[model samples]
Target: MKKACKIYDEKTIGKFVDNELSSEKSKTISEHIETCPICDSITAKYNHLSNIFVQSTSKQLDKIDTDLLGQNVLEQIKREENNFFKKVFDYFSPKLYLKIASIVAIMIISLTYFQERLIRPLDIIGPSAIVNSVDGNVSSVMIFETKKSKHTIIWFSEA
Candidate 1:
C-alpha cells in the first residue's frame, strides 16, 4: 500500500519555494496543496517571505565574492612577506663588508712582503765620499741622503 502524504513544514515549504525539493516530493506537495487550503495558504506565505528575503538581501549578496576576496588577501600577504624578506636580506648582507676587508688584508700583506721594494728604488745608493789634499793636510767630504728624510748630508773631516 502507498504511504499517506506527509505534511511538509513551513521551512520545507520555503525549500519548495526555492525549488530545493526532490522531483517526487515537489509533485506530491503540489498535488496535496490543491486539496489542502491551509497548506496552500501556508505555501503562498512561505513563497512571499522567501521572495522578500531574497529581494532584501540581493544587493549585499551580489556584492560578496569570497573567492576574489580570499585571493586579494593572499596577494597582500605575499607582498608583505616579500617586503619582510627583503628587509631581512638587506640587514644581513655580508658581501660589501667582506670585499672591503679582503681588499684591505691583501694590501697589508703585499705591503709587508715587499716593504723594501716599495720604500726606495733599487738604483739608489747609500753614500759617496771624495778626498783631497791641500798643503800638508788631507780633507775628506761625504754626502748622502737619509732614508727617512730624503735630504743630503755633508760630512767634512781633516786629517
Candidate 2:
C-alpha cells in the first residue's frame, strides 16, 4: 500500500504545482498529488486560476495606447504653464493694476533718495582727522569710523 500524505491542503498542492517548494519537497508533493485524487483536483484548479490571472492582465495592458496618453499629459503641462500668469492677472481689474504700479514706483523713489543723501558712499568717507606727536621716542594717532556700525575707532602706535 502507498504511504498516506500528511499534508493535503490546497496551499501545499498549489505550492507544489507552482514549483514554489524545495526540490525534494516538491517531488514528494508531486508524488502524493498523483496518488491522491482530492489533491490532484485541487492542484488543477489552482493552475487554472494562475493562468487566467496572467492572461487577463496582459490583455488589459495591450488595450491601452501609451503614446497617446503621453502626448495628452505633455500638452496639459504646456497649457498650464502658458495660462498661469494670465490667470493671476485676470483676477484683478485694470484700475487695481495701475494702483499697484504706482505704489511700487513710490517705494523705489523713496529708497533711492535715502540711499543718495543719508547713506554716504564708503569710498568717499575716510578718516576725519589724524593726530601725531613725538614726546621722547615716537608716537602716532589715527581716528577713523567703522564702515558697518558707524562707530569711531582711534588707532595709536608707539615705538
Candidate 3:
C-alpha cells in the first residue's frame, strides 16, 4: 500500500482550488493528492464551499429592487433640462459679444489712423524731397554747361 501524503494548508489549498498555482506547483500537488487521501478530501471540501458561495450570492443579487434606480436617473435629467436655457443665456449674452466687437473695432480704427497719419506721410515726404532736390541740381548743371560752352570738347580721364 502507498503511504498517505501530508495535507496542504488552507491557503495553499485555496490557491489550488482557485487554479492560481503555477504548472509545476499544481503537478506537485496533484502527485501528492494521488498518494495522500487527506489532501484529496481537503480539495473536495474547498470545491464544495466555493460552489455554494457563488450560487448563494448570485441568487441574492437577483432579488434587489432596480425600479427606484431608473426613476432617480430620470428625475435628475428633468431637473438639468429645466435650467439649461438659463445657463446658455448666461454663457452667450448679447452684451458680451457687443463689448468684444467694439474693442476689436477700436483697435482696427486706431491702427488704420496711425498708419495713414504717421507712416504714410513720412514715406511720401522723405523720398519726394530727395528726388526733387537731385533733379533740380542736375537740371541746373546741364543749363550752366550749355550756356558757358560754345565749342567745348569733353575728355574722359581715369583717376
Lowest lDDT 10-residue stretch of candidate 1: 127-136
lDDT of 3: 0.69
Better of 1 and 2 by TM-score: 2
Higher-TM-score candidate of 1 and 3: 3
Q: 48-89 in candidate 3: lDDT tens per residue?
A: 888899999999988987879889999987886678796676
Q: Candidate 2's C-alpha lDDT? A: 0.74
Q: Please provide, for model 2 over 1-159, each residue's C-alpha lDDT reduced to its tens digit, 9 standing for 90 to 100.
A: 744346667677767887889999988888887888778778887888988999999999999889788899999878875896866776664887879978988988887778765555653465544346425443876666766645667666776
lDDT of each: 0.73, 0.74, 0.69
RMSD each, Å: 20.1, 17.0, 18.0
Error of 3 at 99 (Å): 35
Maximum-TM-score candidate? 2
Model 1 pairs in collision: none
lDDT of 1 by residue, 1-159 (tens): 723335766677767777898999999888988997767887887778878988989978888877788889999878866897776765656898768778999999998788789745533454333334335354876656677545557666878
Clashes of 1: 0
In order of appearance, the predictions have TM-scores of 0.33, 0.41, 0.39
